[model samples]
Target: MTHTENTRVAVNGYGVIGKRVAAAVAAQDDMTLAGVADVATDWRVAVARAKGYPLFGATLEHVRAMTEAGLDPAGSLDDLLGAADVVVDCTPKKVAAGNVERYRERGIKFIVQGGEKHAVTGHSFTAENNYDTALGRQSTRVVSCNTTSTVRTLSALKQAGLLKKARGVLIRRATDPWESHLGGIMNTLVPEADIPSHQGPDAQTVDPELDVVTMAVKAPETLSHLHYWTVQLTREASKDEVLGALRASSRIAFIRMADGLVALNSVKELMADLGRPHDNLYEVAVWEDMLTVQGDEAFYAYMVDNQAIVIPETIDAIRALTEIEADGATSIEKTNEALGITGRLVPEPVAA
Candidate 1:
C-alpha cells in the first residue's frame, strides 16, 4: 500500500498470457515482479530469466545458477506461493481447477485466466465493464478475449436500453500447429457447430438477463478471430446513437462510424497506424462499415486479435485486485456505468 511496500506478485504458467502479465507488472511502480512459476527448462522460465524476473517452480540447480548469475530465483513454486501476496494463474484451462484450489488453501489471492472452468466467487473483470467487480476482490477472473469484446460492446447497448436479445457467430483461427499441441496443421476452417463457445455464456454470467446465441469455426491461421453479431432491440435506435455510444466507451479503442458500414481490415490498419503492437488483449479494432441496423433487426460485425485484447485486460484485472493506485479504476468504472451494466446484479433463483 505504500511506495516502499511493493505488491509481491507471481505468475503461474509462463506462456503468452504469462509473459505479457509479467511485463505489465514490471512496468508498474506499485508492484514488483516477484517471480514466475513453470516447469523447469520451459521457454517461459528462460524468458523470465532473460527479463531479469525471478524464476520460481523450476529446477533447484537451474534456479541457483540463475540466482548466482545476479537474477532473483526461487527454488521452487512453493517458495513463490509462500512469498507472494498475489498469484496469477495463467495456466491452461485443463490445469487451472487444481491450481486454483491450492492457491486458495495457501491463503494467497489470485487473478485467474478466463479460459479455465473452475468455479470461483471472484468478480469477472473487463476494463470497460465490471472493473469494480474485480477491484478490491480477493480473487478475480479476466474474461476471455472474445467475451471481453462482446460484452463491452453489448453492455453499452444494454445500458442505453437498446438491446433486446443477442446472437453471435465466431470465425476463429487455430493457434499454429507448432504453438498448440492440438493438431491444427493443414487444417483450415474447421467449424464447431452447435457447441456454445464460452464467450457468450460468460457474457450472460455478467448479465443473466441477456439472451445470447453463439457459434464458432476454427481456421488454420493463427492471426486473429472474427465475430459477427446481431441484436434485437426493444425499439428502433438510430445508427448515430449506436456509433456514438461505442465511441464513448473507454474499453473500445478503435471504432469507426461510416454511414452504417464496418470493416475488419480498416480497424486492423487503424491499430497498426496507432502503433498498437499487441492486438490480442489490449485493443479491440472495430469497422464502422460492418455495423448495420434496419428496423428492429440490428447486425454488428468486428474482428478481434485475441492476444492484444486479453493481455491488457488481464493486466488491468491484476492491478485492480492488488489495489494498485495507477491502474485507472476510475476510468474503467465510469466506462462500465456508461455501458448500462453498472451495478446490474445477478438474480437469485426462488425455491419451488
Candidate 2:
C-alpha cells in the first residue's frame, strides 16, 4: 500500500508498550492509527479516541463505537485479524503466539514485542544492528530491550574484530503482576547460574557464530532493567576506540565513558539529558576504568534501561520491514554498517 493509505495500522494490546507503539504510529506522517484491540476497558482507549484515533473491536462498547465510526472493530479477536496491513501484537505472551499464527495465515504483517509469549516467523531485529535484514522481510521480531542494547555494542566490536568472547550479568526488576502474568516481579537479586543465559541465546539467534554468556538477577524496582557486561577481546582494543565506535552508531544516543564506577541512577540521568521526547532505542553508559585488561582479556561494564532501549528500534524495524520510505537511503546504509552484518566482508588476515 502507498504511504498515504498505509496510515491504517492496528494495535492489538493497549498496555504500556502497546500505548507507546500506538502513539509512535499516530505521530508518523505516512501512517494512521486505525484501531486498538484490548479486552480491558481502560482509560487509554478514551485517550486514543480523544486524539481522534479510531478504536476498533474490543470487549467493550466504547471500542465498538470506534468501529461504527469507520474504524474496523472486531468484537472477536479473530475479526481484528483481517482489518489491517500491519498488526502490532502487544498482548500477553500466550495470547501473542496464537495471534501471530493467525496473522501469518491471513497474510498480515506484524510487529511483536520482545516479551510476547509466541514464536514469530521474522528475523530478530534491532534498527541499528538489523534494519537492513528487516527490509522487505515479511516477518520480524524485535529482540528484548536488554538484548538490543548489549548486542548493538558487541556487534560493533565484532565488526572491528575486537570481540572474541563475551559474558554478562543482568539485574532485572519485575513489574506489577498485571504487567505480565508470567513472573517478572517477586524475584530479586537471584543469580541465574546457567552458562549462556537466556539473553545470550537470544543474541545468537541474530548472529549464530557469536560467542556470548549471560546471567540474570531480578530486582524489586520497576522502572528499568540493568546489565553488567564483561567481554574478552581478540586484540588490544583501547577503551577510547570502543567508546568512539559506539558513539558513531546512530542507534546509540547517550554514551558515557566512565573513568570509574557509574551507577544505574547516573545512567538514568544521562537518559534524561539526552532529552529524547520519545523513548530511545538504546544508550551506552560505559564504565571505562571498569574495563579490565588482563593479558588478552578485556572486561567492561554498562547499564541499559529496557523500555527506552527497545521502543525506537521497533519504530525503525517497522519502517524497514514495511515499504514505508524514509527521508534518505543513507540512514539505512549506516544502520546496516553498524550491525556488522551488511552481508559484505573483508578477507581475513593471512600470515606471511
Candidate 3:
C-alpha cells in the first residue's frame, strides 16, 4: 500500500472503464497496474488476459470458473486490493456499493465512476472542475461523461466571471456502438416525465453553487453525445472572448469550421488517427462555429465523447484519493503527457 515512487493500482472491472483504467495505469510513470478483476469469465477477461494484466476473479467462486476458462486468475478481488496502493471500482452503478464497502474495510483508497450516487464516495470529482476539492479524499467518483462536460464548461465561465446561469439540452447517444441492445435504436427516448433529467443535479454534486439546468434525450446515434447549451453571461463578450475563455483550459479542445471540422464524426476520426489508446478523446470537443453571442446570451454546442472523456478523470481521481500526487495540475499534466492528450487537432503543429 506504499505509494512513494510507483503506486500500485488495481481495477475491479474488466468492462469499458475498468479495462481503460488498467491500461491508463500501466501507461503512467508513477503508477503500476497491480491487477484487474471481474466476476464474469467472458471475452473481456480474455481481453484482459491478452493484454498481459494479472487477472483476478471478483469472487472466489469466479476464480475456479475463470481459471477453467484459461484466464489464469491470480487471486480474488480482495487480494488485488490488499496488495495495491489504490483500486478503482469500474463496476456497474448498483454493483459498486458492495465494492465500496470492501474498499473501506480494507483501508484501501479507491475511485468510482459517476453512475453511482454521491453517497457511494462522499465526494464528486471532475478533474477539470473540482480537482482541488478531491484532494485527500478516501474515495472519489469521477463524474459521468455528461456531467464532466457540463462542469468543465461552466467552471471555465465561472473562472472568467462570464457565467450567470445556464441551461442546455443533452442529445445523448443511444449507447456505445457495442451495446445495441441497451437503448432505443431507432427512436428518440426521453426520461419518464423528468425535467432537467439527472445531469443538472449530478453536476451540482461536484459544485454545489453551479447555476445550470439540463434537459436530456437519447438519439439513435451512438458515436457521441451532443450538447446544445445557452449560457446567460453577466458581462457582454464577443464570440472570440468566450471561445478564448473556454480554450484557456487544456481539457477543452476547439474544433471550428476554419479547422475543417464540420461534425462530431470528424473529431472521432481525429482521435483514431492520433492512435489514441482506446481511441480516447480526453478533451471535450467544442464547436467554434457554433459559438455565438448576443448581448448577455451566449450559445454554443459541443460533443462529448462519452466513452473516452472519463478515462483521464479516472486517472486524476486516483491521484487525488491516494495523494500520490498532491498537485492536481501536475497530475493532470503528467497523465495528459503520458496519454498524448492535446487540445491541438493535429499531433504535430505545422510551420507558420
Candidate 4:
C-alpha cells in the first residue's frame, strides 16, 4: 500500500539507539517524528528538546520531574502514543519488555531493540532477512548488533547459494562509549560461559533454518564488536565468488586494511571522515582484502558498530510495521539512500 501522508513515529527513549531512531525518522520523507518519551531530565533529554522533537515523560511522575527540572514535557507517554502511528522503544534492556503491554493497549505498532527476548515480540526483524514478515505486524524485535551483522553477511552468502553451515567468534565491546566511565572491564577478557552465545540463537529467531553457532568474549574497548566467521560452503568456491556474494548486500560495506583501516578504531575514524552523523557505520564493515576461500570453507572478519549498525534496520522496520511501503526491496532502497549506505567505505580505484 502507498502512504500519502508521512508515518507518525514516536521514539520512547532518547538514549543511544532511540536518539538515532528519532533522527532517522525525521530524515525520511515518508515519516515524521511525532515526539519522544523519556524519564531523564539530563543532558540527553535536553538534547532531544533542543532538536525540537516534542518531548513526553515516560510516566506522570516523570513528567512532573521534567517540569520541575524545566524540561517542560509536552505530556506523558500516553500522549506520545496518541500522536504516533508507531513507536520505537529503545529503552534499556528489560525496560522495553515492560512497555509492551502499554503499546498493545494503545494499539500502536512498536519495535523493541535486541536486548529484549524474541518472545516479547514473537517476531525478530532484520530488514534484509525478514521485512515482509514484519509488515503490518503489531511488533518486532530488531535483533542485537552482533546478530544483525551476522545475518546481513551470512544471509548474503546464503542467498548466493554458497553457505552450508557457519560458525563465528565474537569480540564484544565491554560497554558503550558513553557509559565506559561508570564501569567496565579493564585488563581483562571475559569469555561467555555458553558455547553458543545468545546471539546465535537470537539470529535464528529471524531465520530458523540457519545452521549457525557462535562463541563470544568481551573485549576491553568500547568502540565496536569484531567478528571472525568460518563458513563451510555448499561446494568449493573461489575467493572472487565469495566476495561477490558478500557484495550483493548494500548493508555490507567493504573496508580494507590495505587502505590503512587496520583495526576497529581506524574504521570508526573513516566513518567520521566520511561525515556520518555520530560517526555511525550502519553497514557491516567487512575486510574485503582479508576474506579468504579454501576448497569448501570461507574465512572472513568484519566489524559491527554496535551503536549504529541497526539504525537503518529500525528505519525500515518502522516502514514495514506501518505498511508505508509494501515492497521490502523498495523500502530497503529508500532507507539506504536516505542513510547514505554504500557497499564500500571507499570508492574502487580506477584501472590504469
Choose the strongest candidate by lDDT.
Answer: 4
Off by over 4 Å in 1: 1-4, 40-44, 58-72, 121-123, 176-182, 185-187, 255-281, 325-328, 331-352
Report the C-alpha lDDT of model 3 over 160-231, residue by residue, as the tens digit: 889999999998888787787775468456552588789999999988988999998878888889999999
lDDT of 4: 0.93
> Pairs clashing in candidate 2?
7-31, 7-32, 57-73, 93-117, 122-139, 174-184, 281-309
Better of 2 and 4 by lDDT: 4
Clashes of 1: 21
Say what the RMSD of model 1 is.
9.2
Question: What TM-score, over all chains together, does every model reach?
Answer: 0.80, 0.78, 0.95, 0.97
**Candidate 2 structure lDDT:** 0.64
Q: Name the weakest run of 10 consecutive residues (lDDT summed) in model 3.
A: 184-193
lDDT of 4 by residue, 288-337 (tens): 89999889999999999999999999999998999999899999999998
Question: What is each predicted model's overall lDDT from 0 to 1?
Answer: 0.68, 0.64, 0.85, 0.93
Clashes of each: 21, 7, 0, 0
Residues 224-267, model 1: lDDT tens digits: 77888888888987777777666665555444455222444445
Candidate 2 residues 295-333, lDDT tens each? 556666666666556655666666776767552244445
Q: Please give the RMSD of candidate 3 to the true structure.
A: 1.7
* Ranking of all predicted structures according to lDDT, beginning with the best and ending with the worst: 4, 3, 1, 2
